[model samples]
Target: MSTTSGAAGAAYDVAIVGTGGIAAIHARDLAELGERARIVTAVDTDAGRLDDFSRRWSVPRTYAALESMLEFERPDVVVLCTPPGLHTGQALTCLEHGVTVLCEKPPALSLAEMDTIIGAERADAGDGRFATVFQHRFGSGAESLRRLVGDPRLGPPMTAVCHTLWYRPDDYFAAPWRGVWGVEGGGPTMGHGIHQMDLLLSVLGPWRDVSAVAARRARPTDTEDFSAALVTFDSGVVATVVNSLLSPRETSYLRFDFAHATVELEHLYGYDDASWRVSAAPEHEDTVAAAWAEGPKGRGSGHAAQYTALFDALDAGAPPPVTTADARDTMELVAAIYASSFTGQTVRRGDLGPGSPFYDRMNGDGAPWAAAKETEVPA
Candidate 1:
């Protein structure tokens, strides 16, 4: 474990692991940050990809192994764009060395793994912090809606809709680890829909319980291609969530129905102020419109928005946004959806922990379809 000069009086040094497509976004956003952060090194086992990434991003250094990069150049923060299966271990390593970690979505394959990562941060008690990428929560539209959650003008939230319907062809899962339960964790529920689910949880404080169903509809993979759940928040706000990778027309939509207004957001991946709409009850139309108009605006949701907030938190010596504890809430929801679906029972927020099967793996009892697929005789 080595240490680089702190970012006390300079830009935070950042090292990006895994030069995949997502890493490009991280590099571009950090570049846009100008002086807040700097990409000092790039790491990847693929030599060709590493070279290309370094050249494209103008990153000064590159390494084929993560340990070597951490040993020689200890960046203040390591942005992990690696696979889900590797997130827990990689994040643990960074925290052990007192370097903050900004990991991509599905930060871990299971709640157990996520807990380990969170534990590492607490045990370190140093400058290291762990933050997951849940960019949807930082968008201006989401910010505005969050502010009005209990605002008397909007009243109490009623029912909600959260859908992540997208398409991924067979070739899209050509990568060996793409749809595997042990690697990618679960299909759309864990990978694709998590962004919107995280955003939903951000708006609705704490969820109470969930009843769900999952199926391997069309995708030829080891995990379910689609899932749906009915979740109830502590505030008595019930929501229907549907996540699918089989839809032909892709859409990521969320609707929150409050007593006085119905607020909705429609977008594919990211959203801005323009993606939101509010419809008010007759008596509160003007009030709702004025409140919506006065809320936060302009900032679009993406890596940049979250990164900007993260840098500000680091500068102020505060825990970064989307901290492990905060992410745990969203992750627990993912686990509950799976547990409820597989067990044909309602799963409450505190139902899963160390003793729960779903805590260690999403397909805790083995997805029924996957079991059947394995037993099918040669046709």
Candidate 2:
């Protein structure tokens, strides 16, 4: 509603398609940036939300559908804040119209859905760029770690661990699509665990194999609210992922162990940022055991912090930290976890590796997660 005009570049003008909780974060960044960008148009399937959006931001353009927004507003960038299942279709639509997209994480449900969009992007030169927000890489702790990744002191990360705990009220799942099998896909893993998982991969590199388990143990939804996964990177690093909405308390953490040192990000915000610790190894067993003290909690909810970095990156014209291809890697891990849980098997990273048939799975009707999902959520 209240935005300055005059965007000059191909990626300058922006539109936000969803007006939910997460969308507000993106909107705030664009709004504060003033003339740096414009929230050209707002859109939602329900339509009533647009009035609130208009009043809040003084936004002038609103549309009920994404295509109509694109047709009328002609923005250069579109930030997708829709639900997880809608990511692929909406992203592909924006790309077709020469709009760069920065969708939220777990970009697609299965390797198959991911493939449809990734394939089209690879083939179309000017369809526009795509990225997902894996903003942990931009966090203060991560920024420090990336700078030293290749240094002799922190060289060759050997392992990583991620833990995320948050409170999710029952009403949070009142939205019909919040915890469905076909729609939301998985629970905390896709919705919650993904942020930590993506951070681990960014630090350790691509995964070579993964073993995982997922279940709908705590929530009423069809998808899982809790999950844990083990990832082995091609670079020989091992990592662990744990995400849960069942926790009464909220905490978030990611730690990496390198050849000579350890790096970590820990905070009270479940999906947000916190303080970081980098330290050397202890020489003696007793000394190491004595040093098992509590660490610092994170400072800000990673939401606003991440947006600061994302908007800065976009302004600089440098590509964001996590691109569409990178987002697919995170989803592959999610898929592998679901597959492993369903089939009681270890999923090879190569099975969904580059050029694998899994990426091209259009309908994704036969996914292992699907088979495992056949059993209804317990009453």
Candidate 3:
């Protein structure tokens, strides 16, 4: 069961828990780490996926259950790419066994679940920890903009726009869990748009309040197909968020208007340095141009950049990027958006807790609208 190589001392033992399509991404990124990390095993309930992943990644061991994998392989790190409903439990299993976890986005279905994962992670005193895959934060362009946030030249971020508008056909929701509240949590807002929103939260920091609306206008799914929100950041930045699955022309875009310059990132899925553009105000044009040019370059927003940084953290015995606290901030935004939309109220950072329905379910009290609303998309 244990596939510890002789080079175990030179590399961290890495195992993947879910052998889905996304698992391939994790494998590819981990493989790029070379000897710094080794793919010790892969786990999946599906025999076909397990075998395919192992053969494709050259992983030496495979398991059908997480407990068996943990007992046998004892990987130093585990990647949880399972569904949103399963993320919390699977991640808890790994952390309880003192294994670090790199969980995919929407790390938990609800705030309660996030609290449970954070508890387990805290109890585990070792270097083994939890980090979320908010890969957009690692982009060179994003890093540049983040750095510029603190500079006086840009002043404070005043207003911003975040949008994730992509088309998902009927076939995309054929899966049983695709649009359910308990399973996938929410529709485009929670699953698809979260990437850009997380990136937004990363650059802007904590959100103070949210007023939003969600509709199941297009998709024939239980969850809302579209959502829009007005967000107020703690730093007094007001922003608008729009997440949709009905757009024929797909795009993932974020724009931050600071006092002295406007920064924008335009891309469909992932972005490189070239995806970002800076338009400086005339008064601070020279300073902004020079600062942007001197920022970090070349790193693209993807799993590889994050995984490499994770391994470096493991080597240094430091906490990895996008820690649970950081991920919680993004999750809080998600909860707030839903709470506001369904309840028709402005949701604050503390509004969602054990007492609020949204604290435990994305579609609090069943969305307050009919699933087959008149605006439902026709197949």
Candidate 4:
């Protein structure tokens, strides 16, 4: 296996695959990382896009395929900004090549695929690690919230709310893969809401079970445009999650109602310390206020912050941030949401495995609306 190790203070080589919108973000963040990382190579099927990205980002090398990049560049890490369907295979390839991968969200379409990637990472030992981009968890606001969750002053988590109510017009789905089940996976729940839900899981720990409902609603898509669920965490914290792609006024919000305080975060896509607010209970107001004030600060949730943490882990020879194991629970929650929505049954943490249909695909028994849409004759 190739080694990720280098002399201390040496910048890790990073090759970004897929020079799309999100890949640009990864490139920008790597540029911001300065000496910690260097974007030595770029890979994309679109030659025009590849050349443009390489020139714009000042990347020294380019390739038409990941295999060619891995064979030649063999960078320490590869940032995968490819489609959901491509993540599993690309990640596995990176692992085989002994290159760490920091993949975009909805890392895989199903729990089974994520498990396979995790298994591959395990086999690689210290050679390569897989981390997912759940940027919300790296922000100081989230850091403070996590610390407070365990502090005696915050008390226990009682209930919570997580919403990813964003709009996507008809034109947004013009891309052939935008709303497809096989390629993009499970619509808003899997793609959009998974971010907030991941942050929720990051703070609350493992979830116990979930009961959900989903519908295609007002979009031309194979998957649900919206979904809602009632999730119960292992700590008995109950939370309501809503993911929608039809809301006119877009918003990403989360509220944690603890015994001592009601912690809330109001933001659109990303959040910082200013996006959060704390309302301490009357009795514990002074202590809770003081504790919250003294917690971590400054860092905001975004690709740059997450990359910073990731580099730190790589530098220390530890597992990268949002390790496949760390992200497995969130991915499981996503699968549970889809499973519960489709099967009309509460799906628990351990309920999905090799035999379960949801284990392999988000649309377990096929979305109920898919058949209806199929039966309808073209107008």
- The lDDT leader among the candidates is 1
TM per candidate: 0.96, 0.82, 0.94, 0.96
Score each candidate by Cα lDDT. 0.91, 0.70, 0.87, 0.89
Which portions of model 4 miss their true places by more than 4 Å? 1-9, 376-379
Ranking by lDDT: 1, 4, 3, 2
How do the residues 246-338 of candidate 3 rate in per-residue lDDT, one tens digit apiece? Answer: 999999999999999999999998899889989999989999899899899999988988987786776567898889998888888998998
How do all the candidates rank in terms of TM-score, highest first?
1, 4, 3, 2
Displacement of residue 88 (Cα, Å) in model 2 is 1.7
**Model 1 global lDDT (CA atoms, 0 to 1):** 0.91
Candidate 2 per-residue lDDT, tens place, 236-270, comes to 87788888899887887788887667767777533
Q: In every candidate, how many clashes are there?
A: 0, 8, 0, 0
Q: Is candidate 2 or candidate 3 better by TM-score?
A: 3
Looking at model 1, residue 372 earns an lDDT score of 83
Cα lDDT tens digits for candidate 1, 32-149: 7776778889999999999999999889999998888989987878999999999998998889888999999999999999999988999996789999999999988888998988
State the lDDT of candidate 4 residue by residue for 1-379, as single tens digits.
Answer: 2344433344788889899999988888777767678888998999999999999999989999999888877787899998888999999999988889999998998988999998999898548889999999999989889888878898889999999999999999998888998999889999999999999998999889999999998999888999999999889999999999999999999999998999999999899888999999899999999999988889988898998888778767888899898778888888899999988899888999999999999898799988776799997
Question: By the TM-score metric, which is better: model 1 or model 3?
Answer: 1
Model 4: colliding residue pairs = none
